[model samples]
Target: MDPVGYSHDEKGVSKEPQHVISEGDHGADTELRRLLSTRHLTMIALGSSIGMGLWLGSGESLSSGGPAGIFIGYVLAGSMIWSVSHSIGEMAVMYPLPSAFVQWTGKFVDPSAAFALGWAYWFSYCITIANELQGIVTVLSFWTDKVPVAAWITIFLVVIVLINVCAVSVFGEVEVIASSIKFGWIFVVIISMIVISAGGAPNHEAVGFRYWNSSPFTHGFKGFLNVLPTCIFAMSGSENSGLVAAETANPRKSVPRAIGSIWLRLSLFYLLGSLMVTINVSPYNPDIFGGSGTNASPFVIAYREAGLQPLAHIMNAVIFISVLSTGSISGYGGSRTTMGLAHLGMAPRQFARADKTGRPWLGLLVTLVLGGGLAYLNVNNSASNVFTWFSNLTSLFTLFGWGMICFSHIRMRYTWKLQGRDVAELPWKSWTYPYAAWWGLIWCMVLMVVEFYLAVWPLGKPSSAKTFFANYVSVIAILVLYFGARLYYRGPWWVDASTIDLDAHRRFYADKDPEAKKTGFKAKTSKTLGFIFN
Candidate 1:
């Protein structure tokens, strides 16, 4: 009997047993279903990422980095994300598990690292849920100070929880609708900025490159570096697509397509959006630092300055929707990640339980409790203070998660070669390869350190001890979790390269007809649209 291969049973058993992790092995009775399509996966990434970070946080980045600095910061951050996404995409297509990186780290790196990364990643997403909930109230306050912040937070908390408890298909449908609105809103804003820059608005001021020339780099290089954290937060959700790979149908096809489209999305939505904001709004606007509300949004400021009060109000409404969409996505991701930890035996078995609808109800309940409680902080703390604390905390954990992904991928590649596996057999392969993985790992670590420094010693002035602690607390927490898990597990510092199992749990399906071809304009047009959109 082979230890790693299937063998016949004694009682005249026939056919090979599936070479994948079974629910019983993990002490669970059910598993998540593959119901998400390509469109759902794509929109999950877009909807999760294009939230308060861009709609609200960009103003802070622009104020610090200036127009050119902000643009450059996003480009640099986008490149780093590209590297991270490609690395994870390769492994995800092969494994296709929820919170796949956690399992990948356990297999290819070290079990301790996996435990730490899983919990840290879960914490990041949980905080993100809270942060987006806070964003709801902040954005709504633009229209009315009538409602208390706590009331709005409670309202959104219930809404997000309800969305997560439903079937994943329902969640996907909501995301598709919300993401479409977000995309359309961005398109309108970008076009409006172009028109305003061309002196088409009532202002009739040709603002072409005017802000850039006046203040290309605010506060100098330090300022440029300052905005990187904000940009990272904005780009954090790029990995949500890969996280959903396990639940996505045809992951081999859909996952890669979704990951590949990230570069385009970042360019079109983030870089272009930043460019438009820089052209239409000045960094010196008092509202640029409007302290955690819709008015702080550069888009809103630009529209109002152009005397388009109605348009500004509409943009505010769109932002509120975006925040809600992102909050819901965060809850979904966080719940799944918690379940993945349980699947790996790092958490209680109940956490791994799924309802008939394939919803991780226990995980969802836990995430809701934590996130909702955190959202209440917004009621007492200043919005800006709450936002900064949550943003900084999430950014640290996110960077750490990216580092683990890159490191795990590098180890996986080495083991793949050791096992004599053909590269061509991989469902997806990262084009940048060894270089990209190394680049991503190094940069993510560097940014993590820089963020810690910035937290302690902010650019302009000395931060209070409480503020500094809030900013750097994530770093300490992760370190403690890693070492604590190591002590308990007592696993090897690193897994042996030759012992890595690349074939376990790989989804096997019948081969498709490679020679089949499509013809006609409708087919060709459909293919073209899929290429562009996916």
Candidate 2:
């Protein structure tokens, strides 16, 4: 019997527990659906990543890093993400599945990794949903200061619950529409700002680098690092992607096609977007963000400051859409993570249950309850700071997950080489390996260290001490829950490799005639779409 990737239910009881794929709970009526298209997956990656981070939080990065500093961060982070995307792309082509990451973590590494990494990664999604809930409430305040944040939180939770309960294709369609709105709004914002800054307006005579000269980033290196908390926070949803693997139509093509260009997409979204914004808007007054007055989308700020008409309200509505898009995505991501954890046995069995539509109904419910409860915190006076506390604490965990991805790729590379595999034949290869992986690991480590110091330093920085301690506490708590549970059950380290079927995954790749028989509802719809498209 294998330790985890393919083991029995009774706590690894048998010496040779059947090594066959457990007629997985979710894919019962079908040979696990292959539903996503490259176009759908690519849009998903773009949509999931290019949101609230840019529309809502780019200002923070601009103010902190300046145009140059922010670009540096995005380019660096984007490069590392590129390596990750390629690594994922290669494996995704080889064996695409719904819970591909979870399966891969278990198969290539160990069950303990699958349990720990999956759960921790899932927890990040959960925490982010709470954070986004807070954002929605904050944005809604623009229209109505009278309604309590808690009420808005409930409203958004209901929206997410309804969406989650819908059929999977409905979920996919919502994603498509939501992504369209976000990308559309961001493009509009960037273009409008660039034009406003270039032409002379009524009162402000063509503000050209005025803000940059006025600010000139006098804060130095440490200050640059200091404001990076949100910069990191902005890019949080990239990993939110693996959640959709179970639903992707053709895992091999779709996952790679979707996950492959992370670097380029994020660069344009984060790097190019920030440059336009910083050059257009005031750098970082902290006064413009939310305190008083119109609190314009900084793009609107740049425009109106240049004597443009009241564009702030328009941008506000756009931001509302962006938040809704991101919040919905956040919920979907959290629910999938919960489902993955349950299916993998790290969570309660009930949480793994899905409705007839393959919706993880219980998982979605739990995420709602948790996310809703967190939103209730918005009514508290300290809600804003608490939001910061949670937001600041998350990047380290993201760094860890990415680092594991790099490690997993290294392991996969070793395994591939061990079997005398040819690099040229691989679908996608991570560049300058040993080099790229090492550099990425170093970058991830540096971010962690800087973040750790930011959390603990007590250098008279207010949020650092508590944030550091709390972040560590959450990580430790996650570790304890995963390893402690594993030890209590006394699970073995490795499973019979043969039991972990890569054949089903390979079949999807091998079959030239993709128009095969219907597997289930998801497959039928996907097949219909493929027939139409192909």
Candidate 3:
């Protein structure tokens, strides 16, 4: 057998990869079903990324980084994400394999790297689940403190788990509906911001560029760098589009289309949203710093400050929904990643178990039990504090995951050249070859160093051992996983690019028709809406 677990016959035809699960438990349909349509892929890409990181945590970003700091930070982060999307899209279109990055790292890089990255990446999603749950507790407090935080956490936890453990079609439909609601709410918020900036509020005060003018940058260059972590948090899940390729009906078409649209989503939703927040809300507002619920949201703060009290309430409710949408996405991402780890034999075989409906129920249960359970930390610590802890950890892990993606892409490209393969043979090619990959990898390292600086001296706070270790624990965890896997597996630190089995699990052999089948008005409508829902 090859190092990646697939063997080839004398004729060079690839055999099926070895399975970790036993035959008795491997009932019919062991793989996730390709039931998700292009619509589902597009919406998941858009919705999974629009979460508490923007709605509530942006307030903390503004408080620490100020208006210009965050706006610039997001711009840089957006570019880095663009590179990552393209790099992953190229590979996903060709492989269309389960556990997208995990498999890629194992095949193209090294098995040890795959084992380490797989677990860390899964834990990142888990942390995101916990972060969103904590956001829900904070958002709900806007309406009533009479209800216990634990009650709301439990209610939403059950709801998300159910959504994830069902057939993926159910999960896809739910995401489309939830994503639509989030899109509408964000549109309303952006338009409201524009109107309010132009003195449309009852107070008739044009706050045009007032916040930016007062203090565009906070805490200087360090403050701008500090904002990068929150930017990573906000844009963390765009790569999940590639992760779902194996579950998509037509990954060659849908995955590239979805990945290609990431730039537009980042530009419209995240970039514009952050810009509006900066223009409408003052960074120095006491309420924007360390409060709970909608009171801490810059959007809600801007509305209330403009005397638009009712709008503030409506915004908070929408934010509550946004939290649920993201929490559900986190669950989906976590379960799938855990299942991928199991398939790679990096985890227990039971984690790979799926029901007849093709739901990874056991993995979903584990994610809910471990990841969802972290939400209860709000019972002891303040919701904002817990949010900060998870966000910091998640953001660091995201950087590492993205960096590895770029590194893997670089290694794959080198191997492709050594194998005498033509770039034209690829189903989808990255927009800019080695440059995009290098750009992403370089920025990831730069930001990792920035995180270290902030860990030592947090924004607007004195340096403390507690703060430093808390911020770096995520980094330490990944290093531990990587070295531990190396010690156990006793494999080469890095696989030789020349020896990589590039053809393993590759979905395409001889090229077929590049054009997709168009049916009727529905297909035409889908094609017409390709700009958004491709």
Candidate 4:
């Protein structure tokens, strides 16, 4: 390694840091300042997590599991996500980087895990971005059905790409704007739903929790379990906030606060949002779902029930912003993940190149353009099939990433004890370890098993068709391609710690704030207060 610590590009590419092609070679890629604040991080986390899913799919989940069932499902999954967020928060503070999980998986687990998780996550976000851009055309169809989805999709692709390509702060600003619109729509819908349900409307009497109590299907443990995946998916933005960890000035502070915001997102946004949807309209009605149109969102349906004209138009606008913010973040995520993979020798090295704004320009644009193409192609036919494939596969890889995070924490905890370290030294400790991680794994495993069964038999009935794969033949195809590449490359299943880079990290991330020049402010403050009291 050179004295400055940056490894030279193998192909003798640009000597510039931004153009560095390899990782495990410590270096800086851009002159971009770390500018994101706690507030930005928090909103970014919420914005990325709150997707079109809540607006689009909650009705189906509610239908499967009644009001109580839906609530229980979200509460349960949100609780687990909270635990995972904290676990991630604790580690993130110690090692903030754009390749957040990639570093951890490589350093703590193995290079292979990092590579696999990074690529899988990258693909997932790519799919999500594609889906989001595709949605814009569908939403705009409310105004003029004559316009082609492809044309609008191309237009939006350019707009979002320009915003992202400008600068990190610019991207952050645009995301916040989009997020505000999303939040505003959800809040208004929720409040309006409450007003309508409380004997405020002529046809509707005070429902007063009647919708939660009544459902076509039996509501109980069975129902709650059924809606669990949807709930988890709604709160799915757990990994995004940390995507900026490396780019922020004080990730140590911003990331934890962003992590804290998960609770707020779940409690205030998701919970209230679901409650509003359930109360305004009953989930059991066939009118709510199983519809002829792509406008199957529960929020829009409730707004219609409350006598809102141009119901599709209103919700469509809200969803448009939601899709934009989410897809932008997803593109960011895919680029960073690619950079991480390139660093780990899992992918070719050009992806590590960054622009003057510290953004992975080529990487982000590639994912965006590719995702846009896939989404626009689906304009001829409904893209539900593509959406489903991306969602399930992405969730699968995410579950794997979660497992690695928990396991890495477990090892860190042990290493600390062995080195005579104290738990108090950590900036944040996981709410409950081993237990939380184990139970999460168990829960995910159960869900995976059920999904497999549902995929094979479908709704509990046996199917003998060899072609039937729950219509997930596409996912299988991707998996085969991925594993087949692994076989072809003879990729190592395990990584050696010695082969990994373990340099002293930036102080902000490792929680050894150089500016403070003091350790344990909380501890010091407590001791001084105790002395005074004594």
Best by lDDT: 3
Go through the candidates in order and give each one's C-alpha lDDT: 0.80, 0.62, 0.80, 0.63
- Report model 4's TM-score to 2 decimal places: 0.81
TM-score of each: 0.92, 0.83, 0.92, 0.81
Model 2, position 508: C-alpha lDDT score: 33
Model 3 C-alpha lDDT per residue in residues 1-534, reported as the tens digit of each score: 233345666866434463332212221124677778778988888778888899888888887788999899889989999999888898887766567888788778877888888888888888888888888888887778898988988998988888887788998999989888877777888898899999999889998998898899877888788788888998899888877777776666787778866877887778999999999988777787354334467888889889999999998888888889888887887777877777667878787777666688877887778877788888998877887888889999899889988988998889999999998888778768889899999999989998999899887788999999888888999889989888876746777676666665666534443345667786777766775544
For 1-534, candidate 2 gives per-residue lDDT tens digits of 233233354654333222222222233122233344556566677777655556656555565556556656666767776666666666655544445566566656666777777777666666777777777776666567898777788888788777767777776778777776766666776677667676645664566677667764635666566556566667767765555655665555466557655755675677777777767766555534433344435655665566655666676676776667666776777676666566555677676666666777776777767766766766774444555555665665677677776766667777666666677766555455777766667777788778766666522357654456765555675577567657754556654443443333332334443434556787889865753342
- Find the 10 residues in a row with the least total lDDT in model 2: 16-25
**CA error at residue 210 for candidate 2, angstroms:** 3.0
Worst 10 residues of 4 by lDDT: 14-23
For model 2, what is the error of residue 1's alpha carbon versus the real structure, in angstroms, after optimal superposition? 11
Give candidate 1's whole-model lDDT.
Answer: 0.80
Is candidate 1 or 4 superior in TM-score?
A: 1
Candidates 2 and 4 compared: the better one by lDDT is: 4
| Candidate 1 vs candidate 2, TM-score winner | 1
lDDT of 4: 0.63
